[model samples]
Target chain A: MIASLRLRAAVVSIVLLAVFLGAWHLATRSTGTAANMSPEYAKLMGMTATQGKSAMPGPLDVGAKLWEHLRRPFYDNGPNDKGLGIQLAFSLGRVMLGYLIAVAIAIPLGFLIGMSPLMSKALDPFIQILKPISPLAWMPLALYTIKDSSLSAIFVIFICSVWPMLINTAFGVASVRKEWINVARTLEVGNFRRAFTVILPAAAPTILTGMRISIGIAWLVIVAAEMLVGGTGIGYFVWNEWNNLSITNVIIAILLIGLVGMVLDQILARVSRLVTFPE
Target chain B: MSIFDDPFDADSRVNAGCICGQHRSPAEHEHAMSALRCEPVVESQEKRYENVVASAVLRAVFPEATTRRAFLKTVGAATALAAVSQFFPLKTATEAFAEAGTPEKKDLKVGFIPITCATPIIMAAPLGFYAKAGLNVEVVKTAGWAVIRDKTINKEYDAAHMLAPMPIAISLGLGAQPIPFTVPAIENINGQGIVLSMKHKDKRDPKDWKGLKFAIPFDYSMHNYLLRYYLAEHGIDPDTDVQLRSVPPPEMVANLRADNIDGFLAPDNICQRAIYDGVGFLHILSKEIWDGHPCCSFAASREFITSAPNSFAALTRAIVDATAYASKAENRKQIAEAIAPANYINAPVTVLEQVLTGTYADGLGGVKTDPKRVDFDPFPWQSFAVWMLTQMKRWGQIKGDVDYKAVAEQIYLATDTRKVMIEMGLTPPKDSYKSFSVMGKSFDPTKPDDYVASFKIKKAS
Candidate 1:
């Protein structure tokens, strides 16, 4: 029965893949011909006519180009050297580094503010002021201050990642059960032991949710930051391909970004699951 | 000595027992011990002397190794490697010949906004200029300059008819990816104008551009930069003296009409449309402010330029030829008719012809005609580029000192441009540089490097 189920799942996945590719192929072919049928297209198409040669390349021509690039994808073009793998790795590394830094700074701050009314009053104004500012708005200042594109991009990711995590962490820490604290006090537990043993475990699930949100924000900011800064990153790849006027390549880049983002979120989801108590 | 007499003595019973196995006379044993000690000491001394001599020989033979000789060898090897790498890149570019050879990537898509400067591109497409150059060009209509820049950088289009500064700004990585860009050909020059709303007629005259609220289109846009530069020349601070707001190009006329903005800088065609509608009047033509200023050009990726040199050259020739044709009086009507597609500006033939011909009725009953209004001379405008670099420095768009000559050399490919001009029987100017005296300050293009260095501008240290 298990073997049959596995076989059925495999067949379903294969069929889905075939259907997706078939739809893509048909859509591109139809659009390609329609675009060429216009008068403007005819004028442009006339430019490439050699006595017997075809002027405009059809969808097959672009597909061939795509296949050619896919075959040897590790080739380095110039100073922005590295394959797509290396570029994605660089981008992912920046995202994680920035996300971790943000969490490290935000969590403790959130805890302190959440625990004390006075502390919350002091920090609330600043948080409210900063939360509404877009990540793109911070790019110019970051670029000027940091003087390095890679670090600027990382800093942008950090700025974007911190807010949701901080808010969530504060809410998580503040909403801890009053009964648990009373239980710890009756047991005559020390403050440090009580805080770690009772408060932390109670807040773990919420804090993990905040971390998941932070990671997703980091991933989103990194792409825009990389595009603005320019270097070996997935964002740069998208911008570079777009500048070359390759629409198919742009689609490919968008797909890569989406796939990578999904994987990152899934990883965070798994991590959160491992830490949190089952419902 | 006896063992019981002195337990710590050298001649104790334990010592005597040790010497009992190989017993010899006292004088002979002493002599053997002395010989063994001296032999080792002599051998060690000899080894030390040999080491010193060997080190001295090595030092003497290769005295210059630490200095000049090693340095020269390293430099020579580096130079050779650099030369080889420069000559042979990874991907061999396909040659783009006008008369022959297949276009490497033929189904070309280009993007442009409806600006007067891009009139030639609109004209060229319908007239088969791009086709003649072996480009299957598709002109994608963009919303505005920002969208055009975004789309161009994103690779939605192969090339673009863009503001001259767009490519430069993008290449320098001001706010976007440092895409390598080059203007293969100049599209048109001196089509932009500054206009004032009718509400300003009582407060300010047409000549007084400084006393009004200047509605700039976008930050870091050419219109904003140029307006700021023009204001500064007249001793007006754009920040303190007047309120500057960011408004889109399509809304510039409406904003002025609604009295929301006092004045705005826009292209000639749009300003003329507003004047014809009796909403606003021409304050000053930016062309008059800086005559023969390089405004817009046909920009392409550096990758495209390198990959398809022949195609680039062909495209340049086509643009140059088209510029010549469009400038002639006989071809003016035909050029206007060709560009009248609804997807383009959708303006009547008369409006396009008047703007293209540089004949403007100043909206105050006066007509001004300048024959050489928009000079298409590619080489002499290196001064304008230098001027722009200086302005960029002044406005904090660029930081640190760039080698102005090198930047000019990269952006302005005089050799290729001039070669195309010569083939067309046009006299390509021998002198590369020109001098401009703007607001009584003389800027010599020949001394561009020194000129940029001497400017009192805030630069990144």
Candidate 2:
């Protein structure tokens, strides 16, 4: 029965996508073939102007461009132009580097804040003020202070990713059950050992949840950061195509961004599942 | 055949001379001559360098080609060089020029918005102008004029392709902290146009533009000033009668198609792209408002110039060299191809060709040709700067008392450009100030206050 339900759900998803695509295709179909235009004049006109095609590209146009990109996805022509695979790799690389750095700094600081009441209160005001600010807002400041664009982009990602993990880790560590700590203390476990063997294990699920949230946020911010400081990345690709007003390439970039974001989320979700323990 | 070839020698043909003197045009002669006299400069590299320097100094002292040639013929090249070296440190200057050829920093980054206004800066990279000058320069395609300004100011970029007024604005502390910036060279002139959406094709006259929204690339851009001037001349107050938004050049076409803007005064390529997209048609070229008006510039900070003078000079030489090549009509098609790659301007070849070649469809089912639609000239005239300042003050961007001439001379590096032009064997303009008219009203660079006061429709001070 469960398998049949899954099959029915998949069928519905496919049906919805098909209907959407069909409507888009019909809406964008060529309506008038430009008649009586000289060959020389037609050569200078865009596809829409000459063939009476809609300005908005249909799914087929996007699909064809996507297929061309997929066939050779690692071509690096120069700094401004790179293949989709290379662009994606550059973006993922930045996100991973930034996310890992955030994990390193946030986890330890979070532990200190979580374990001590005084530290938590002292740091709370600063965190509260900073947590709500958009990552892109720091672009100009980061660029000015750091004096490097790529490093600034990575720094932006780190700042955005830290707040979520820091807050969640502190919350999880602070809320450990009193009974578990009492049992560990009574057994003569040293403070260090207790942290590693008991507190860490007890808060593993929550900490992993925090990491998962951070990875998602980091992925989201990388696109915007790379877009702002363009050199070589998926965000740069979107911007380059947008400069030419190539909607088809932009659609492909959007689709790729969504897919990459999903993959990053799934990886963290699986890690979160690994740390979750049944009572 | 070459500028360096001796015009005094009866055996040599110096000024676009055909092998048989039967070619229909200079371009045809060049095509037919091919590689015959291209090896005219057979001197050693060092000798050629000294010769160029000597000739420039002689030309400067004489100010007349005939007298210089007569002097050279009388005393011979070696004696003439020795005589000049006595008055001027010829040997020391030659060594310095040679040393400056090896740039202090080899790797550099230049920021540019992907537009035809940046043709020389962009083409310099792909066509080996930078490499030839012993620098590996990466022309990073920037997102917008604001980002370009920020990145350059942060020292992330070595230099940048900027709107002509940007360096002035930066130097004067408008919209950004006052950082001493300099315009080493003007990139292109007369390369902008006012494009109206196809729906408003009949509304060509500026008087009919009231209640319509328009987009300019930036608040301090030539596009904004020209658009405002055009409107004010037509009795339409830009501030009260119509709305103007600061839209980046790249997004103008999409915005026009989306019906977000009725028109835009932007770079010629953006104007061409709008017509290519069938969303807009050319209302009037900016050249119609003011021909030979400065649009974009090759700018660097004063800090960069002080820290790395040699590299800055090399970069400027590459730009000036590329500008000279792009000035000729025959080279336009080749340049269009070189800058059309995905890594550069990233536009269709035909769109670029139409913009560069100055022959394009007007989106009204008509083909119009105007070769001077976009031309490259690298002189950074201080008079242009004075004109811009007057407009800035008139538009209320600058308030209180102003020293227009001092500011213009400081921001526009006319002296530096003159030196570079002489070094390259090109004639530098005698004076940095010249009067030019905008919309039938002449501007006297010597009297900027008068010009500012004369604007009838301006932001009331």
What level of docking quality does candidate 2 show?
medium
**Proportion of the native interface contacts kept in model 1:** 0.00
Worst 10 residues of 1 chain B by lDDT: B1-10
DockQ (C-alpha) of model 1? 0.01
**Candidate 1 wrong stretches, greater than 4 Å:** A1-279, B1-101, B202-211, B218-222, B365-380, B449-461
Superposition TM-score, candidate 2 onto the true structure: 0.89
Query: CA lDDT of each candidate?
Result: 0.62, 0.86
Residue A67 Cα positional deviation in candidate 2, in Å, after optimal superposition: 1.9
For each candidate, give its TM-score against the true structure: 0.49, 0.89
Report the number of backbone clashes for model 1: 5
Query: Can you list the residue pairs that collide in candidate 2?
Result: none
The candidate that achieves the highest DockQ relative to the unseen native structure: 2
